[model samples]
Target: MIAASVGSILRSFVDGVIVLNDRHEIIWHDLSEEISLAAKAGLPISELIPSAGRLDFSRYRAHSTVNGVPKYVNYSTFPIQRDGETIAVFSLSTNESKLKDWLHQTIEIKRQALEKEKNQRNERNGTTFSFPDIKGKSLAIKGLIKEAQAIALHNADVLIVGETGTGKELFAQSMHNHSPRAKSPFVAINCAAIPENLLESTLFGTVKGAFTGATDQIGLFEYAKDGTLFLDEINSMPMTLQSKLMRVLQERLVRRVGSNEVTPVECTVISASNEDPEKLIEEGKMRLDLFYRIAHTSIYIPPLRERKEDIRFFTDYFLAYYSKKFSKYVPPFSEELLEVFLAYPWPGNTRELEHLIENVVIRASETDEAIEVDHLPAYMRRKIFADPGYRAIEQKQKETKKRPLTSIFSASHVHYIQQTLEETGWNISKTAKKLGITRQSLQYHIKKHGLGKRD
Candidate 1:
């Protein structure tokens, strides 16, 4: 009698209410007539709501199609406890299908708003970098590029992992340009740079009268529709915002702030982080579930230091690049200066190298034929000269002037061969050309020395 009375009251109060045992098997329900009783019979709650299995979140939205009709539902699950132990779960669900029309209207309104903004901003729908723009021939970089190119045709979310100055944005842009959506906008946002209070609305969008100061707005997700949205420094995003981001990624829908209506989002997301994502998860700075969702296709860019063979190539490229920009003569680095560059550890990676060369080019005299140590900044000069590796190079150069070439070759032949291979991106022909030997001779040396991929 009591159970019947409670069911009667719940049916009048809620659109539907269901009870489940600890194992999530439905024990009882007061479902609406429109819902499918056949579908709910003797099934786990997860069958109705995917996220209901863990029961981790406080609320969840679920959509189902029944008899050619769509049903949108808002679900709230509560634990029923006795003697301080949860024995069953009670879930209250409300049909939100009525809001479907509202969702569509909201999307159309935002689209019109965004179209106006795009015209005012004069935004272009393309990127600056293609595969060729990624300046590296090292095996690590070449492998990374190959993976990126292969996946660009797909629409999966991409996660780029690397240390700062590893050119994560360059990879993101290249992937966007190579994809089928190349003609669409390539929107990039720095999650760490934006203020947290405004970050949510900026990405997902906002409706008029959503807040006192808020006006109708289209977010980055909408702006990048039919294209790519690059989220840089993702680890720096607040944990609260990360939850909403995960939902958008999973459902491909975004609900503006202060609005219950959800709009469809079709843009591909490419997120990046300079820090190790695992460490960030352990530190509570990033959510593990979000990481898993966004990292469906992962790319890790090796640091410049790890690929030291590319240093000289990048140096020369940057020199020529900045020389043309400044309209100055492209001066070569003195032997002593080049030795210092090779020996010194570049902590700032390619960006640092580029900036340093630009400074050197600007400081060069019209009569200068080569850049010497004096041309470098004071800090770099101090760091390079203080390095013990530079001291060793100086001693080696002095000894090279006195000893026979064969003696030097006998000492560092394998090491020289390995460095050349890496610099040429393991291309046998290029390595041979750089070493002034035939490709067959290079292959024989590689096998002879058992040199493989470098660390």
Candidate 2:
């Protein structure tokens, strides 16, 4: 009778507990009701635990649910040691909502402190990095920066569209740096880098022995939980993976390969694509449904050629960066060199400019102070003399004496209009609406400028 009474007391004290064997399997669970509910809700319990062989007990924390509602729980685990060898692990979990709340508050405070520390470090190191590093004196660039800043505070998916080498990644990083998830991991994966066969497993993960050589592995999506996932070159993502990706975006859940169990992940998705995704959809290379699902909010970064006015700024910035990096004391660009740089059309954009500057900084003689036109790459010198278009444009502007519209219109109006049209897949009505222009005006501009027309 005393033993029966002791058993009853022990059962009453046990609120909710999940016991895992060395291989992180749910061997026993005291909260059967909650587990059933979770299963019914499509959340698999298998993902919540690790395999016995791969168990890292220190990484596991007990969480609690009060009256079956998920309140925070705190659990501690210790290896079951036998003869100085760990045979298994024993864990104890209890209601820890109040403690979790306190810790969360403390963490936030520490996060602010860390941000301050980072800012101080940057300042001390004389780093001029930020959204401002996106060099542009144009109003459009400024507006873009402002809009991106405002959008960063929200937890919305952002789609960045731009030509290759137009700083899409930089913009994505800036958004993450200024976001609520700034303290969390910022994971970036190139959709085009992974093979089509492995893309699904790379993004969503796989279970133990799901395939040959498939040890239990967590995907980029799971690693980025409670953080940000920057999907670069999203247009290159395989069509088969698009459907699965859409499911993940819509359901906020992921199921490992060969496992029906779903793991819930809370992550912000930021995607970038250089190609015209709408066209890709039309061409059947991309799925329209996936496009709409991912493009919640969109921003386009203009190419460097369009933003000629910013060239000098970027050049000076790159020159300074490379000078310090290469431990060279090269002086600023001379008037001739600056003029040549301004005249040259940068096909490879900012990336090319950065490389050119680095080369010059590293190779410049100690006696040579200022960077001159002669120090420039051979191709740049040849291009300047070979192409008469640069001189023709300068002559036309000089004769017209009109504020050079190319500098302003090229960077902001023309590129923005082209991007909007491409996003709408040349649907004039939608493109016009996006551009805040009348359909007739859009048509007139399209014809007058011969935009998107083949030579």
Model number with the top TM-score:
1
Candidate 1: what lDDT? 0.81
Each model's lDDT: 0.81, 0.73
- For 1-455, candidate 1 gives per-residue lDDT tens digits of 99899988886756787778877777988775324442655444466644443354445343555676666666677777789778888777766676676898999999999887776444666566778989886888998999999999999999999888889999999998888988888999999899998999999889989988998898999889889999999999999999999999999998888788888999999999999999999999999999999999999998887886688678777877888998887557765676688777777778888889988989888576567899998988888889998889878877877785654345487788888888888998999899886454566566556789877
Candidate 2 on 1-455: residue-level lDDT in tens?
77556445545754355666655556655553433444456655553433333334434333334466575444445556668766665444454555667898999999999999888754432222358667777666788899999988999999999888778888887888788877677788999998987888888898888888887889988988788898999999888889999999999999988888999978899999998888888899888888888888889877776776677778777877777887777766654466566767777778878888888887788676466767877877677667675576557656545655554245467777777888888899999898775464576567545689323
Tell me the RMSD of model 2 versus the true structure.
Answer: 27.5
Worst 10 residues of 2 by lDDT: 47-56
| Cα RMSD for candidates in order | 28.7, 27.5
TM-score, candidate 1, is 0.60
In candidate 2, stretches whose alpha carbon ends up further than 4 angstroms from where it belongs are: 1-135, 366-370, 379-455
Distance from true location, Cα of 163 in model 1, Å: 2.2
